[model samples]
Structure formats: C-alpha cells, structure tokens
Target: MSGAGNGFPVPDERQLDLERLDLERLARLRAQLVAHDCAAGLFYDPTNIRYATGTSNMQVYGLHNPCRYVFVPAEGPTVLFDFAGCAHLSAGRSAVGEVRPAVSWYHFIVGERVAEKAALWAEEIAELMARHGGGERRLAVDRLDPAGLRALEARGIAVADGQEVANQARKIKTPQEVLAVRAAVDGCETAIGRMAAALAPGITEQALWSHLHQANIELGGEWIETRLLTSGPRTNPWYQECSGRVIEAGDIVAFDTDLIGLHGYSADLSRTWVAGERPAGDAQRRLYAAAFEQVTRNIPLFRPGVSFGEIAARAQRPPERYRGLPGAALAHGIGLCNEYPLIVDPSAWEAGGVEGRVEAGMVFCVEAFAGEPGGREGVKLEQQILVTETGPELLSARLDETLL
Candidate 1:
C-alpha cells in the first residue's frame, strides 16, 4: 500500500512467484503424507486447503460449512471439490488439477439428508483412493463431520490425523514463504501505524480497532482473527475483545494484531501504548517495562537446535506481583495462522507444552503480559521473529519508544 516507513522494505509482489510457492507447498504436504504413511490428504479446513492447493474461495465461510475440500494424493494430481458453480475460481492455478462440485453434508445444507450426502461424498473419496492410492486405503483428513467419518469408515478407508500432517508440513517455511511472511508483517505494521496514529482520548475502542481493519483491507489484506484492542481497566484481564468503552487520558491501550495479511500470511504482533499526551505514570511504566523485558529476553533464546522446554525453562518471568496472569503462550509458531509448537511458562508446560525443536526456517511470535494482581492497568507485548541459522531475527522491529 503506502511506502515502507516502518524500517522493513515494502515487499515487491513482482518478486513473489505464486506458481513456485504453490509447487513448494504441495511438495511439503506430500512429503508429510509420505512420512505419515497416508496415501492421500483430504483437507476440509480452509487453511490446510490453501496450504496444499493455493486456491482460495470464501475461506471463512468454508471453515464452518464443509462445502469445499480438496483431494491431494501423495503422488498424483490434486482434485478440488469446490462450492457449487464455483469451480471457475481454481482455473489457471497450477496447483489444482481437477475441479468438481462439492457434496455438502453439513446440517444447515442437507438437514435430514446428511447421511445421504455424506455417503455420496465418501464414495467419491473412496473412488479417488482406489484410482490413485496405490492400494493404500489410509487417508489423512484435517476436518470432517462425524457422519462423513462414519461413511468413510464404512467403505474400509482408514483415517489418520491430517491436522498433524498439515501442521508439520507448515512448520518449516520455504524461502518464498518467508518472503510472503515479510510482506504480511510489513502490511500489518503499516496498518498498526495507522491504528496508533488514530489513538487519542474519547475514541471508542471499537472505533480505534476499526482503523486497523480498514487499513488492512485497503492494503489487500484478508481479515483480522481477533478484535483484541482494549483500554484502561479492560486491559488488566487479557483477551477482552474491543468494545464501545471510550478511552481516557493516559489509559493504556493494548492489542494483538492477529492480522492475516497479503497472500494469506499472518502477522501476529502485539503492543501497548498510553492513550493521551499525559506521560505514563509509575505503575504504567513499570508494567510496560516488565512486558517489554519479557519479550526481549525470551526472543534471544529461540535459536536453531533449542528445545521448546529449554526455551520455557530459560524464559524471563515477570515480577512476582505480575506473575498471577500469563498469556496463552510464551512463544508460538506463526504461519498461515498460529500453527504449532506452543511454548508456555514452566508452571503450565506439563499440560500444554509440545515437543519440538527450533528449526532455522521456522517463524515464531514471542509474547509477554505484565499486569499486577488487582492492578488497574496491564501491558501486552509481542514480537514476530524468524529463526535464522545463527539466532532470532526480529521481524516486527517497530516497538513504541515512548512507552518503552
């Protein structure tokens, strides 16, 4: 959209080869299918479908309505079952080979005939496996209705965890994927600048949050995953969606830009700032400093070859007063969406932690939240990082100096 004033150069779309990206992503998914020993992958989740085929149509709508899906064979052509009459959408895409009308079996669509539709859907899938599965009946499916699963099982098809295959495939970013991520972050930060410039006393939280949405849409970005902008006391307990509460002078406005930017990549970054020109008070500064330190301290621990547990063990904790509240993750992988390898605090690691190693091509968002127990204010800070062979590279480099 506008010039890159956020230090990172604006991504040149000319440099992005969509066909190459599609091929690379398809190869990655196939590799994962081979590793998982599945003959094919049946992707119903729109994100996984986009990853495997690079063809998108009504992504959010496709999420809940299983009206669209793709059949990706481990060693054959990709067949897209598009929404009725929407097969034209995948035309000219090298990643997609055949396009057919989808058989939707969701309750909203088929009502009492769900079983009938699911049977039809399963038959086609079984036929595809017979034709291209090389005698393997195992299929990896990301998401499916219970009826659909039962119907497939009736046909002797074995289903495996397809989400795992998709996640593992999406974990390592190709060089082109990294470039796409850079473009997304650049667009997201530009939108963040717009939102920040609009912050002032008397502005409703919803109104302020809309600036980020408007700027993202104007820049060809898709959608924001959450409305996380909050001000004043609302910022204390995190995860409060933006509302009509009018911001006051010196109020702390904290938000996470779970922005899905250009090319369907995500730029999940967060920041907190004081509302008005009135300088931040002592409590505000202390919260901001702690949150800032937590993010900055944890970022360096994310070099290649490090274990997820090691990162959590060595992560910097907030002051004792602020330790009562913790965000969902200390660091998590970022790709098409917040995908895998959710690193958490040591206290909660036993339950929510994942087993994984930091690879050079992976990207992550290091997170921090500092809000004293019963305090009126809090600070949320996050940074997007790309793991290099040597160490972490800060992708979201424009931190608020005034608040810091």
Candidate 2:
C-alpha cells in the first residue's frame, strides 16, 4: 500500500495480497446469504464486490468511478460484470468464479460508461442467473440505485434488499481481518508521530499535512485520509480538511487522520494537539475525558452475551460540559469499514430487535466517545481493540498522551 498518494511510499504496502481476508470473507458472506433464503445476490457496492470477487476495481478511486457490480448467484457461483478481459480476475488467490466484460459499453456511449455498463450489466446479471437456475430465484441486490433498481425490476427478477444480510455478516471481524486492521492503525499512529514532529507555530496546516504525507509515503502507508491538522476552534469539528490556516503560537492543532494498510484495510484514527504549550484546550480535554469515560463505560458491554442496545442504554456518563459541550458516550468501532454498531444510528439496534453481541475474536476501535452518524462532538476517539475471552483486547497499544 503505497502511502504516497497519501501515506505509504512507492514499493508500498497497498500491494499486500488480501487472499486470506478474501477467503474468510467470501465463505462467511456465502454462508450468510444462503442461510437467509437469498437465491442469488448482485453486489454493486465496491466493498461488497471486493468481498465477493476480490477486486477493488472502482473502490480504490474512492470518490471517483461509478462502481463495478459483481453478481453472485446463490445457487451458482460469483461473476463480475465489467470492461474488457476481466478473466484475469480468476487467476488471483482471491479469484472470481467468472467474468463478463461487457463489449457493448465500449462502442455504446461516452461519459456515461458506468451507466451504460450498468444497464447492459443488469441484463447480464439476469441472464446469468437464468442460465444457472432461473425463474423466481428470489434474487437480492446490494447498493442498487434508482436506475439499477428499474433495470432489475424490468428483468422480472425478484430482487430483495441484500445489504441487511451483508451488514450483519460484515460487522463481525474475522481474526485475519482484525490483524490487518491492527497493521493499518499501526501505520496511522506511526504517521501521527511524523505529523506531530513537524508541528510548530507559523507552520501551515497544509505544510504539516505534507510532512505527515511524506512520512506515510516513506513508510509504505498508502493515503493520508483526512489530514485534519486544525487549530483551536477547528478542533471542535469534524474531518475539516487541511486549510491554508497557520498554526500560530499558543494555538492547538489536531491531525485526525489515517493510513490504509497493505491489505486495502483502512485505519481511521485521530490525534489532537497544539503548536505551543499544548494548553488543555477545552475541546481536546473534553474529548479525551469523554473518550476515556465512555470507553470505560462501554467496554463491559462488549461481552459475548450483551445486546448492542443494552450497551447503548448503559453507556451514559458524567454530564460534564466543555466549551459548553455536554458529556457523551465513549468508545467507537474500528473494522473493515467504520461501522460502529455500539451506537446504532442507521443500522437498527432497537430494544429487543437487535441481539448483536461482542463475539470473541471480533476487532473493534475503542476510541471512546465514538460510534455512528448523528453523534455529539468529542467522538474522534481512536483506539483499536480485539474481543477476547478475558475481555476486549487492545491491538494498538495505547500510546503515551502525545500532548501535555
């Protein structure tokens, strides 16, 4: 994963093969999908496709690329619908079972490649399913947009929303995946040292991020992620990108950033500080305090038999206010994705409906004051841990407080 584009250098770790993660993930996904009565599922989300077919294809470009869809028939095997000659995908350790590189899209339309390919690709998904074991097959679709939904509907395929099964299976971290996440966080923490080392008054946020970027590249940590080297009031915010703002003397700077490890696994971590005496800025102090308090509050809830809702209910703490910020829950999640199930914002973990618990061997980001969308500030907690028999195990050793 060359951090150069952000963190790891050339000869980077991004190239680290994900064969092991792929196998475990695929087996898990397959078992879950079949068990759910889904005859076949079309995965268009890049992450899902990668989980099934072992290809980043468009997921790597991050914001760009319209995404490549991979179809895995429950009765049959998995295949990818993309551009020319993707048969090589079958050659990898995490190989796809089949490849359908659509030719019509090549001469079909310009600027609308993904749309065109998707249109034609939807037909292929239907045809492939039919050929394998057609008619009322109880199909499922992952990440379907309006257009894609119409196309699948027209095909007469009974497509059900497949993300639910996917989310449940994906939330738990396999041991291999956990190890990879730990490695990624290690890279993030390493990059943090580099970012802090170059910090000082008069240094621009862009300049410090550049320093952090360079170190990540040199260390083979691909991508700087969110270079939030903010000062003072900005620290009380979200992933505010690097501005030309200068870190004046006595001001604070927080570099809430990360590096994706060699395995394409991401590490979302943050570090807050100042250019001068590292004054106990209310925002930083409150976040750290909330994080510590919440993590301590939630760690016990992570056992094998506890429900996520139970943990959420019990996670309340001392209602301290910082810069008028009220006290909040601590401990967020860290995994293949930034899925914080403990704080079920979008993913439904209501009382009695959700029985999800901390299974042993599951990896988590215990950055206190964290979890889900619609969360209060001071949630940029950044610790990573693994669930164990004794309890949640810290993977990234808690470092010395980097600031005074």
Candidate 3:
C-alpha cells in the first residue's frame, strides 16, 4: 500500500492538494498531438484545460470572466488567457515549465473589455502562433461552434475540433489518475454523511439539499452542481430537487449528486433511502430492496475488458431483468464532467459507445437505479469505483446497505 507496492502511490494530506501532477504524461500527450496533424489546440473546456495545464483557478470566476483559454500550438509554446487576480494559479502551479505561458488568443464577445479586446487579442495570438513556427495548417476547436469556427474558416484558416483530439487521450487513466478519484470519493462520503443527518420527514427536500451544498463547500468540494434530492413521485428521470416538497413518513428520499474535488477529479453518485425507523413502509421497502439489488447484485458486471454493450444485454426487462430506473443504464464514467465517454447503459454500446478497455487505473461510478415505471416510488444508488488488477475498489466507503 505504501510507495508503489500496490502499483499506485497514495499521497499524504498536504500532497493531496494537487501538488504532484504527472508532467511526463503531459509531454507524451503533447507528443501525441504533434504526431497527429493538430496545431494550436484551442481549449475551451475547463476540465480539459485543467487536466493538461493543472490550473482551474482562473475559471473559479467562470460567470464573469468566463473567457479563459489555453493553446498549445504544434511547434510553438503553450499560451493562456491571462487575467487579473490570477496569481494564485502561478503560486499553485502544477507542472511549472511544461506549460509555456502566453496570453489570450481567443476573446470573449461579451463582458467588460471582452468584445473589444477579444478581436485584437485573437489577431495578436494568431500572429504569435505563426511566428513560433506554426504553419498555416488547420487548428482544432473542441465544440462545433459555427460562429468562431466559421469565422476562422472565412479567413482561409483550417480549424479542427479540440474534443476529437482529447477524447482518445483521456479514456485510459494512469495510476495517479486513479488515486485522485479515490480522494474525491473520500470527500463525497463525508458530504453525504452531513446531508443524511440533516434529512427529516418534515424537512423540505430543498432544505436537505442546502445542507449538502453547504457541507460540500465547507469541506472543499471544488465544484458540485445539482445536489439532487428527489423524493416521492418526483423521482422519475429528472435529476434535480426542490426543498419545497416535504418528506412524508413513507417517502423514498433519493440522494444524488455530481461533484468535483479540489484536485479536479470527479465522482457522481446517488443513494436512495426509505425514511423510517425500525419499520420501513411497504413501497419504501420495495424501493430500497430493488436499489440494493442493483448496486449489490447487478452492478459488479463493470470489470476490466467488459464491454458496456455486454452489460446492457444483462439488463433485459424480463424474468431476470434488473430493477432500477425504468430505462436507466447501470451507470456511467465520472471524470472532469459527471457524464462522459463511458456509460453503463447496454444500448449505449449499440450506438458505438466507448471501446477503450478499462485498465487498472480507470475511475468510474457504477450507477444503479430501481423503481417501477408508472409506479409511485423509485430508488437510485451509486458509488465511486477505481478499477485495479485485483478488481474494483470502492472509493466511497461510507455507503450503507440500509438507511440510517
């Protein structure tokens, strides 16, 4: 367990703050991009940029200064959209010289000094990239935004999507990546405990969620959206909750959330419980039992080399059908975003889903849902998992078989 005996290094408390990111791994990534025809990767995705450069502090103020960008030109140095009050990024810098610092190639069309500066800055950045041996080759953008993308095309510049290049790189997580996921799971368990203690029959669903939000922030949750606490009949496929709805004695309180740790690792999980003391009501009991069955009995099919299509085939609705959400797949992969390439649904594979084999260090969440369609109750449960040579390791260990 110490050093790399387990083939993974566990960092101490101070080290867990994201001090040791793998720069060599990043070098290989850059080499891969260079090998490909990609030049000037315009990074718009926050997590994508963070994974490559090891800094999301610039995006902490996403709403106002939402126009942060990072560019690693094929033959040129790396560049970013420089901002005020961003000294924290340099102080907490991860891979020091790996990311060559340059400023603002793309500009935001909105906000103060945004539109005016964006055009000028974009021109300046383009010139810098060209001067640094960047040929007139096509540049890649992540999303298919026709405006910015087309505008560049109008200027006779070839544009590529950054996502196309990134997807293949992030699929297979390294050993260090697995450790970060485990740390995120630990933080999520603590947050869940605080939320559960705050739940009560008379308390509103919103109030329960408020407790979770406050606890997560207090405990250093980097960015958690939708601390979804769906209850009673509101628990179909909707992934949000309102505190206005009071928890009835027999209601099924489903706790679901998507979270990011301080280290930029993500873990999305859901746990449903029937609120009662010694005697859990009939509908509530059924929901809990079904949810338990999914997480305990059915969820373990997510092993290395196992195809998602194969897992979906196991969930056929019949005599041996798995019970959870009516049309929900078993789960999905949790990374920079709550949702990404890998999904637990069997049909997802039918759609040409992820084909990369799950390696020893891949981190994912095994989401399990149980509820009768058109029925008045529902249940959903999820846990963070890190795949290893031995098997799947549970990251969130606070999860209990039954409600507290």
Best by TM-score: 1
Off by over 4 Å in 3: 1-12, 15-19, 22-25, 58-66, 74-76, 84-88, 92-121, 131-136, 154-156, 237-240, 315-327, 347-356
Candidate 1 Cα errors over 4 Å, as ranges:
1-11
Q: After superposition, how far is residue 238 of candidate 2 from its true place, in Å?
A: 4.3
Write candidate 1's Cα lDDT for 1-404 as tens digits.
23565543354566788888898999999999999999999999999889988988998888778879999999989999999998888888889989999888899988899999899999999999999999999999999879999999999999999999999999999988988898899888878878878899999999999998887887788989998999999998899899999999999999999998889999999989898899999899999989888888889999999999899889998888898875647989999999897898888989988778999999999998999878998899999999999999998865776765
Q: What would the per-residue lDDT of candidate 2 be over residues 8-45, giving only the tens digit for each residue?
A: 32332343347877778877777777877777777765
Best by lDDT: 1
| Best-to-worst lDDT order | 1, 3, 2
TM-score of each: 0.97, 0.79, 0.81
CA lDDT scores, all candidates in order: 0.90, 0.60, 0.61
Backbone collisions counted per model: 0, 29, 14
- C-alpha lDDT of residue 370 in model 3: 60
- Candidate 3 lDDT, tens digit per residue, 80-167? 5545556456554554333333333234544355444445545654665576535655666664344455445544567766775766
